[model samples]
Target: MAQSIAIVSPAVTIDNTLGALFVGFTVACCVYGILLSQIYTYLTHYPMDRSIYKLIVLLILTLETVDQALIGQIYYHYGISNFSNPLTLIEGAQTWSFILQQTLGSVVGAIVKIAFALRVWRFSQRNFWITGLIMILTLGGLSLALVFTIKSFMLPDVFSVVKLRVLGTISLGVGVLTDIITASSLCYFLNKLRTGYRQSDSLVSTLIKYAINTGALTSVVSITTVILYNIMPNNLIFIGVFFILSKLYAISFMATLNTRRVVRGKGTDRQNTTANHTNIFHLGTRVPSMGPSDMAGWETAYTATSATQQEFDQQRPIIPLNTTGFQDPTLGKRPAM
Candidate 1:
C-alpha cells in the first residue's frame, strides 16, 4: 500500500518569530532615519569638530547601513524568497546575513561603549580605575558576543543556537554592567564639576540627565533582548530586539554629540548676558592694589589667572564655560569704601 504524505502549514508561532522581526526592522529603519538626520546636523553645524570625532560618526553610519542591508537580506531570504517554503520558515534557518548581523551588532555595541568609556575617562580626569573597568567589561562582552556568533554559525539552525544561551546571556549582562558604570561615572564626574553658578550647575545637571537617559535606554533594551533570547531560544523574537540594539547605540552616541551644540549655545548666551553686567577682568578673582613698579607682577598674575581659567574650561567636556566673565554667587558683593 502506498502512503500519502501530509503537508504541514507554517505555524502561528511566526507571530513571535517573523512578526517580531518585521516590527523590529520597521522601528530600526525609523531610528536609522533619525540617525541620518543627526549625522547631517552634526556635519553641517559642527564642521569644526575634531577629525577623530567625524571619523567615528562616519564609521558608525557606515556600519549601521551595512547592518540594515544585511537585515533586509535576511527578510528577503525568509519572507520573500522562501515564502512558499513553510518548512524553512518554521525551522528558523540562520542565514549568512543573520550570523553576520549578530557579529556586526557586537562590533557596533563595543565601539559605542568604548567611545563612552573615553568620555568617562576624560570627565574623570583620566581616572584609569573607572575607565579601565569599563573598557574591560566592554571588551569582555564583545569577546563573548563573538564566541556566541561563532557557535551560532556552526549550528545548523536557530534551535541549535539555544544551546549557547549561557554565553549570550553573559555577553549581554556584561554590556549592561558597562552601561551602568559608564553612566554613573559620567554623572559623578560632571556633578563634581559644578561651580555653583546657576547656569553652570544647570548645564551640569542637564549633562547628568543625558548620561542617565542614554545609559538607561541602552541597558534596558539589552536586558530585554537577553531575556527574550533566553525565554524563547527557538523563536526569532529575541533576534528581533537584537536587530534594533545596534541602531539604538548609534542613535544614543550621535544624540550625545549633537547636544554639544545646544549646550554651547546656552553657555555662550549665559556668558554674554553675564558679561554685560560684570567686569570682564574681575570675575572669579580679586585684584590687589599695586604700585607702578608692580606693573610686571600684575601682568604675570593676569596671565596666570587666564591660564588657570583656560585649563578649567578644558576640563569640562560638554559645556566649555569660560569662567573668566561669570561671577560666582558665593563671593558676595565687593565691599564699598
Candidate 2:
C-alpha cells in the first residue's frame, strides 16, 4: 500500500502542477481579454455602434466571466487540495466545472463565429449567397459543439469519453475549419476592398493582420488540444488549451472592434477630400493623370466656383504695363519735372 501510494501521489502531483500552470496561464489571458473588451466598450459609443454589436460583445464578456469562474474552481480542486491524489485526476471530468466549461465555451465560440460571419456579410454588401454559405459552416460547427457538450454529461469519465473519439474529434475539427474559412474569407474580401491609397488600404491591412493572428492562434490552439487529447487521452494536459479557446475568440473580436475607431479615423480624414469633389484618381502601380497636390493647383486655376476663384484673383496685384504706342502718364509727366 505504501509503495502504491508513493508512486501514485508523485504522478498526480506532476499532473496537478501542470494543470495549475496551464490554468494560471489561462487566467492571465482572461484578464487581458477583459481589458481589451473594456477598451473596446470605452471607445465605441452606443449610437456609433449598432445595438446588436454592443449586445454581442456583452454576451461574450459575460460568458468569459462564467467560463473563467469554472476553470478557477477546477483549478482549486486539482492544484490546491488534491494534487497528491491520483483518484482526483479523473474526478474533474464528471463535475459541473467540466460541463459548464464545455457548454459556455461552445456558446461563446458560436457567438464569435456568427459575429465574424455577419462581418463577412456586411463586407459583401448583404450578399445572401456568400453570407449564407459561411453561416452554414459556422452553424454546422456550433451544432457539433452542442452535441459534444450534451454527450459529455452523459459519459462516465474523461477517459471513457475521449475514447469515443468521434464526438471530440468532430467538434474541434469543425471548429478549426470554421475559423479557417472565416479568416480566409475576411482576408480575401479585405484585399479586394483595398483602395490602393495610403490611409484606407492601411486600415484594411491592419484588419487582415488581426484576422490572421486571431484565426491562426485559435486554430493552432484547437489543433494542439485535439492532438494532445488523442495522444494522451488519460491526461488532462489538453484541458488547459481547450479551456482558453473561447476566450481567445472573444478577445480577438474585441480587438477587431477596438480597431474600428482607428479605421474610421483614417477614413474620416478622407471626408474632406470626398466633399471637395475633386477628380484625382488613385490606381495600383499606376500614376494618376493628375496628382492630388497638383489637383488643388488645377482647381484654383479653373475652379468654376465663385468663392475659391475670387480669392485667387484678389491675391494677384494689378501691374500697369507700358505699350509702344502709348506711354503711362507717370512716365510722360517726367519731362515737365
Candidate 3:
C-alpha cells in the first residue's frame, strides 16, 4: 500500500522553482492592475485624449491578458497537476504555450519600443534617420523572434528551444539596443528643447529622469535573460526570467503614458495650489495653475482659474494629453541643427 502511494522526490527542485515562478506571476498580475488603475486615473484627470491612444491602451490590455493566459495554462497542467506524476513532467514540458509566449512577449516588447521611437520622432520633429534606426532595430528583433517560432516547431517531433541559440541571442541583443536608443533619443531631444528659463528647464530635467528610469527596467530584464540563457542552456531559469519580461515592458509603458500628474507634481517646487487644480501642465506655454509666464515674479496666488476662461484657453488650449504623454506637440522640440 505504501509503495503504491509513493511520490517522486527527484522533481522537488524543479517544482519549487516553479512555485517561485508562480509567486512572481501573482505579483506581476497585481502590478498590471496598478497599470490599469493609472489608465483610469488618466481618464478621470483629463479631458478625452485622441482615439488612437485609447485604442493602444485596449490593445495592450488584450495582449497582456492573453499572455498571462498562455503561461497560466502551462503552470496549471505541467507544474501543478504533474506533481503527483513526475514522469508526466517530461512529456508535458514546452508545448504551444512555450512557442506562443516567446512570440507574444516579443510582440509586446516591439510595440513599446516602437512607441518610444515615435516619441523620439515627435520630439525631434521627425528626425528621419534616428527614428528610422530605432524602428529598424524593433523590426529586426521582432522578425528574429518570428523565425525562432518557425524553426522551433519546424523540426520533426522536436521542440528543443536550446537548439535555436543563435536566433534567441540575436533577438535579445537587438531588443536591448532598441531600448537604449529609445531612451537616449528622448533625453537628448528634451535637453535640446530647454527654453533657457529656469522653470521650464526644471520640467525638462524631470522628464529626462523619468525616461531613463522607465527605460532601464525592461532592458535590464532582457539582458538578465540573455545572460541566464548563455550560462544555463539546460535549465529552466532563463524561462522563468523570460516569463515576466513582458509584464515589465507593459507596466513601464503604461505608467509612462499616465504619469502627467506625477511628473507635473515634481515641477512644483514652491508651495502648490489645491490638488484638483495643481496638476495641469501645458508643455509649451506657462502652466495656468502655476502662474503667469513671468516666473521672475512667480506667485502661487495667481491661480489659472482667476484668469478669464477664454484667455487661458487661447494661451495653451487646455488640451489634455494625447496618449504618448506629449505635453504639447509644438511646445517641446529641438532647435534645428
Candidate 4:
C-alpha cells in the first residue's frame, strides 16, 4: 500500500504544478488584457492607423485572457479534487480557447509586424533596399501566422500528448524564424538611419529599438516553452511562461507610448519657445517703447521729443505776405514785389 501511494505521488505533484501555473497564467492574462484595453482606449483619439493597431492588440489580449481563464479553471477542476465528472466540459473549453488563442495571437503578431514594417517603409522611401527588406519581413510574418493558424486547427484533438508536442515544436520553429526576420529588419533600418543622419531618424530609431527588444523577449518565451514542453511532456508550466510573455508585451507597448509622448513633449516645447520669441519680436518692432529697455530710456525719449517740438516752433521765423503792394499802418506785414 505504501509503495502504491508513493507511485501516485509523482502524478499528484505534476497535477499540482500544472494547476498552479495555469492559475498564475490566468491572473497575468487578466492584468495584461486590461492594460492592453487601456492602451486601445488611449489610442482611439489618435489617427485611424494607430487606433487600428491598438484595437488589434486589444483583441489579442482579450483572447489570451479568455484562453488562460478557461484553461486555469479546467486544471483547477482536474487537480483540486476528484471532480472527474466535468472532465468533458473542461476538455472542450480548454481546446476551444487554446485554438482561439493560437489563431488570434498569430494574427495579432503578423499585423503588428506589418505595421512596423510599413512605418519603416514610409520613412525609408528613397532607399529601395530598406523598403524591400521591410516588405520581405512583413511577408514572412504573415506566412508564419497563416501556417500556424492552419496547422493548429488541422488536428481537432490538440490537447493530446502527440498533438501538443508536434504543434509546440512547429510553433517554436516558426516563432524563432519570425523573431529573426523582425529583429534583422529593425536592425537594418536602425543602421540605415545611423548612416544617413536624417532629420527624422531619431524617432524611427527609437521605435525600431523597441520592436527588436519586444520581439527578442517574445522569442525567448517561445523557446523556453518549447524546451519545457519537451522535457516535461505533460506539465503545464508553459502556461505560466505564456502569461509572462503576454504581460511583457503589454509593458513594452506601454513603454513605447510613453517614449513617444516624451519626444512629442520636447518638440512642443521647442515650438512654443519659437512662437513666443517671434511674438515678442513682432511686438517690440511695433511698440519700440516696450522693448527690453528701462523705463528711464522711454521717459528720456519722450522729453527729447517735446524739447524738439518747442525748438522747432521757436526757430521758425514770423513772416507775413500782403495781397496789395502797400501794408497797413497798424499791421506789421511784409510786401513782396
Candidate 5:
C-alpha cells in the first residue's frame, strides 16, 4: 500500500472574495474622494482656509487607491505558477504593498487625530496646558507608529517571519491608546461647549461618532490580521483577510474625512455671514446711529481731552491759564460788559 500526502496550494476562493471586496471599497473611496475634492474646490472658491485640510484628506484617498490596486493585483495573480514562487517579483510586490498599506493607515489615523485636536484648540479656546497635553499625546502616538513601521520593514531577516504578528499587536495597542486619548480630549471640549448647546453638541457628536467608528474598525482589522497571521502562517487566506481589512479601513477613513469637510464648510459659511453683518455695522450702514467719521472724531476729541488733563496734572504749575480764558473773537466779552 502506498500513502499520499496532500499539498496545500497558497490560494483559494477566498482570494476572489477579497478581490471583489477590494474593488467595491476602491470604487467607494474614489467616489467619496471625488466628492471631497469638489467640496474642497467650492470651499476654496469662498476663500476658506479649511480647504487645505480637505486636500490632505484627498491625498490619503489617493494612497488608498494605490493600496487597493496593489492588493487587487495580488489577488488576481494568486496561484498562478509563474507568480506563486516565493521571492519572485510578484510576491515581493504583494508584500511591499501590504507593508505600505499598514504604514499609510497608521500615518493617516494619527494625522486625523491631530487635525481634530487642532480644530478643538482653535474653536474652543482651550487652555495651553490642555492643548499641550493633547499635542504631546498625538506626537507620542505618531512616533510609536513610525517606530513600528521602520522596525517592521527595516529588519526583514529578523522580522519577516513573525513581523506581521508583532506589528499587528503593536499597532492594535497603539491604535487603542491613541483613540482613547483623542476621544477623551474631544469629550473634554464637548463638555466645555455644553452651553453652546445645539451647534456645539451636534458638531462634537458627529466628530466623536465618526472617530469612534473609525477607531473601532481599525482595531478590528489590526486584531483580525494578527490572529489570522498567527493561525495560518503565510497562508493565502491570511493575505486575503489582510487585504479585505485594509480596504475596509481605508474606506472608513475616507468617509470620516469627507464628513469633516462638510461640517467645516458649513461652519465657514456661517462665519462668513456673521462677518458680513459685523462689517455692515462697522461701516455705519446697518445701525445708522453714528456715521463712521463722526464716531472717529468723537473718539479723537475724547482722547485729546483726557491726555491734556493728564499732562496738566503731571506738570502742575508749569502751564499757566489766562484770565481772559483764550477770548472767543466771534463773541467779544468786554463790549458786552
Candidate 6:
C-alpha cells in the first residue's frame, strides 16, 4: 500500500490573505477621497460652526491621514519590500506601523462615537442617563479595542492571534451595541419632538431617518468585521474590513454635520407663508440653525424653536428667541434656526 500527502506552504496562501489587505487598502483609499470632499463641503457650507467643531473635523482628518500613511507603509513592507520573502507576509500582520494604524483606528472610532454621544446629550435636552450610557459603551469598546490591538503586537504571527479572538469579539460587540443605542436614542428623542404640524413632523422624520442611516453603516461594518474575524481568524479578511472602519466613522460624522444644511434650507422655504404661525419661529434675533459650529449657539437655537412650539400648543404668547443675532452669510435673510 502507498500513501501520498500534498503539502502546501502557508506563504502560498498569500494570494487569499495578503490579497485581502491589499484590497482593503484600496477601498480605504476610495473612502478617503469621499472624506476629503465631505470636509470641504463642511468647511464651505458651515463656516460659522463652532471652533471646537471645526477643530475636531480637522483633527480627525489629520489622524486619518496618518492612518492612511501607516497602512500604505504596512502594505509596502508586505508586498514590495519583502516580495521574495513570502514567508514574511504569511508569518504575521505585525509591522512597525501596523499596531499604530490599528490603535489609531480605535481612537478615531472613540472620537466619533463620543461626538455623537454629545449630540445625543443636546438633542435629548441633556438627558444624563442616555448620554452617560452611550459614553460608557464607547469608552468600553475603545478600551477593549486598544487591548486587542496591543495583544496582536505580542503575538508571534497571524495564526497566533486566535487566542485573542474573544477579546476582539467583545470589543466589536460593544461597538455594535454603542452604535445601536446611540442611533436609537437619537431617533426616540427626535420623534418625541415631532409636533402634529405636517411640516414639523416631516422634518423630525427626516432627522430620524438620518440618525438610522448614520448609525447603520458603521454598525453593519463592525458586525461584518466581527463575523469575518471569527470565521476566518487565520486570514486578513477581517483586517481588510477593519481598515475601512475609521473612514466610515469619519464619513458618518461629517454627514451628520452637513445634513443640517439641507434641513435648514427646507425649514427656510417652509417659512414665510400662511403656515408661518404654525411652523415658523419668530425670534427677536437671528440664530444660525442647529449645527456643531457652536454648541452654545446650537443649544440656544434648539431651545428657541422647540420651546416656541410647546408655547404655541399651550396658547401662550410667542416669546421671541432671546439669543444674540448671528447672520447666515449664505442665506440673505435670517433662516429659521
Name the candidate that leads on TM-score: 6
Top candidate on lDDT is: 6
Query: 1 or 2, which is superior by lDDT?
Result: 1
Alpha-carbon local distance difference test for all models: 0.74, 0.65, 0.68, 0.50, 0.48, 0.75
Per-residue lDDT tens digits for candidate 3, residues 105-160, read: 99988887887787787667688999999999999999999998888775432125
Candidate number with the higher lDDT (4 or 5): 4
| Alpha-carbon shift of residue 236 in model 1 (angstroms) | 1.3
Tens digits of lDDT, candidate 1, 199-306: 656767777888899999989999998898887776678888888889889889888777764654333232223222111122111222223343333323322222
Q: Sort by lDDT, best first: what order?
A: 6, 1, 3, 2, 4, 5
| Worst-scoring 10-residue span by lDDT in model 2 | 280-289
lDDT of 2 by residue, 1-337 (tens): 2243346444333544455446655664666467565646644432344455667777777788788878777677655676576455544456678677877888888888888887776555566887787788778877877777777778776445665567778888888988898888778866876666676567667767877887998899899988977886655667767777887787777766665444445442322243322332221011122234443443223212234335656797866565567755686455654
TM-score of each: 0.77, 0.71, 0.73, 0.57, 0.53, 0.78
lDDT of 2 at 9: 46
Look at candidate 1 and tell me the lDDT of residue 264. Answer: 41
Tell me the lDDT of model 3 at 2.
Answer: 19
Model 5, 1-337: lDDT tens per residue? Answer: 0011012223323333344334545554565465456545434432332445447656666765676666545444432432334233222433455456556656655666566566446434555766677667667756766676666666443125455466456655665565565556655554544334455446556555655665576567656656766775544444444444444544554454345335443222222232211111110011111233433322222111224434655687654556567655786456654
lDDT of 6 by residue, 168-274 (tens): 89998999999999999988877776657776677777778888998999999999999988987767788888999988999999887777646654443433233
Model 4 clashing residue pairs (backbone): none
Query: Which stretches of model 5 miss by more than 4 angstroms?
Result: 1-51, 76-95, 127-160, 196-211, 226-337
Better candidate number, 2 or 6, judged by lDDT: 6
Model 3 spans with C-alpha error above 4 angstroms: 1-12, 15-17, 91-93, 155-159, 262-337
